[model samples]
Target: MNTLNEINWFPGHMKKALDQIKERLKTCDGVIEIGDSRAPISSFPTYLDKLVADKAKFYIFSKADLADRNALEKHLDKYTALGINTLALNLTDRRAMQTLINRLSLVRTRQEERFLKLGFPAPSKRFLVLGIPNVGKSTLINSLAKKKKAAVENKPGKTRSESLIKVSDKVFIIDTPGILEPNYEDKNIVIKLAILGSIRNDILPLIPLTDYLLEYLLKHYPQRIYERYHVSLDGNCEEIYLRIAKERNFVSKNQSDSERARSTLLTEFRNGLLGGISLDE
Candidate 1:
């Protein structure tokens, strides 16, 4: 992998998005911070610490279907201890929609006092969906609305601007572009984000990222590699990737197609074919 400082993770639009968020935040009553359940901590932006300090923040661990129950429970316990309300959700599940509505309803009640103290009558509750790319910020909006109000795609940074959607008469949502800081302070967090598909695959080299994923999977989920491709948890990451490549016949024309194998491994891992693994433990 290249040095973390060398890679330009943030683009111009993301910076503009941050400014837009701060400007738009003034009208919002609370924030629904979406994070990948597979990597809750890393996916949650640190810049939001001060940004959401005064706002009612509800943390949602999105895509729980791809995470381990044990790891998810552990993260839930940690956040609960901190007094932050959190919900683990699979956006495809209809029940999760109702669960979110009920939770946000409670959040509105909790924040009403804060609003009243500010010399204002409690008005409609507005929530901005904030998270890194491809963490389902838009998907949550679409799910809640039960219609395609916001564009839904399986790519990061698809939401380039904020669009309002009315989920209920009193509840509103703003879907914004995934906000990553202009710079990455820690490379491991970047790798974690890349591994979880929050960042686009093209931003980084495939082999290095795949190598990191290999190490990460072996550490956090040893059995998954064997289960999916019959590749045992053995040898270094490159050797393991090579082994899988050879096993899957990724080689042809007298040369091994390591790139194709890497893509396959990453896609399967992202698609949850490697079992329910969590990188945020």
Candidate 2:
């Protein structure tokens, strides 16, 4: 993998998005911060610490279906213990989605009470849906609205602007473009995001990322890899890649197609084919 100096993870549009978020946040009642459940801590933007400082905050660990249950529970416990309102949600599940809407409804009620106490008329509760790129921010917005209010895609930077989405008469959310911290310097976090498909694939080489994934699986999820590809996890990542290549018949010009094998491995893991794996652990 290249050094941080060699990569431009924070682009121009992201800076614009951050400015837009700051401008819009003045009117928002609370923040709905979403992050990937598989990597709750790393996926949550560090920049948001100041952005959401005094606001009523609700944290959503999205894509819970793709995360290991034990790891997810640990994260949920940590946040809940901190007195932060949090939920682990599989966005596609209607029951789970309804639960989120219900929680937001409670937020709205509390917001109304606070406003009324201040002698102001109860106003609509506005929330800013914030997170790093492709952590299902738009998908969560669509689910809350009970329709396709925001564009949904598997890749990063799909939503280039912020838009107001009405979930109920009294509850509104702003869907902003996913933005990473401008000075984010964690290479491990970058690798995790790349493996989870939150970062653009071309920004970093896939081989090192795959090696990291293989090492994690070998330590914590060896059974999953063996079950999926019938390849033994008895060797280094290069050897494992070769074994997977030979097993899957990923060959080109009488050589193992390591690139193809790496890409496939990443796709399968991202799509939850290997199992419910969590990178944060």
Candidate 3:
């Protein structure tokens, strides 16, 4: 994981995209910042405030369906209390999203009207939906349009370009490619989120991350593991992993323990099979 200051993961294309965002910021009225709900603070780009300096901003905690409801509520409250207009959303909830879209439109309209009275042409009320890779920006676009207007996949870096999608007559979304801060140094937060699938799991080492997640689940979401895999959590993390492996019949014919059990458990937990769990809380 890379920290914002020590980010070494920014590719050439991402640098170009960052340049484009800076250029396009002049034409846009505000920004819609999207982040993973489960790890809101960690997943949010630390440099976003500086990048969008003084711009009207709204925060969307995406994948709210997979987050603890209480945690989500508290996150919303915390952000809102800071005077940031915030929303927690499950991409599948169209009715609730309609309301969100409406609110965004109203905000844009208000901004546009204020600009109009100054005798300048109405600024295009553009919203840049920005987040780290795989934070579900594309899925949010699809959900808002009620169709597949943008490509969406479980993999990271799926949407690698900026796109404009109109959700209503007044609201337009500028979808940017996901950006990763270079070489994040916050190993613990990174590992936790990777296990949650909030970060790209493919790029990370599964065994160590899975081990960390196993320990975490044992302490925080013990019932979730027991309920999902029918494993007793009365033992150590390695024992728990072995129990899950035995239950799922994940074994090597060589009579040795297979690491597949750990991988499977990690994947299931990431995909929310263990329920809507939040790693941070």
| 1-281: candidate 1 lDDT, tens digit per residue | 45667787798888899999999888897899988889888888767879888888899998999988898899899999998889999987766798788778777544688677898877678998899999998889989989887887888889887788888767888999997867666688898898887778788778778888887778877777788888766778777777788888888787667778889988998899887888866
Residues 1-281 of candidate 2 have per-residue lDDT tens digits of 55655788888988998899999888897899998999988899767888778777889998899999999998899888997889998876766776777787776445688888999987888899999999988888887778788888999999987788888777788998999876666778888888888889888787788888989888898889999989877767888889899999999999998788889999999999988989987
| Superposition error at 180 for model 3 (Å) | 1.6
* Shift of residue 223 alpha carbon in model 1, Å: 1.8
* Regions of model 3 farther than 4 Å from truth: 1-9, 108-113, 119-124
Pairs with steric clashes in candidate 3: 1-184, 2-183, 2-184, 3-184, 3-185, 7-182, 8-182, 8-183, 9-182
Stretches off by above 4 angstroms in model 1 are 109-111, 114-122
Candidate 3 positional error at 162, Å:
1.5
- Deviation (Å) of 92 in candidate 3: 3.0
RMSD of each: 2.2, 1.8, 3.1
Q: Give the TM-score of candidate 1.
A: 0.93
Worst 10 residues of 3 by lDDT: 1-10
Clashes of each: 0, 0, 9
Scored by Cα lDDT, where does model 2 land?
A: 0.86
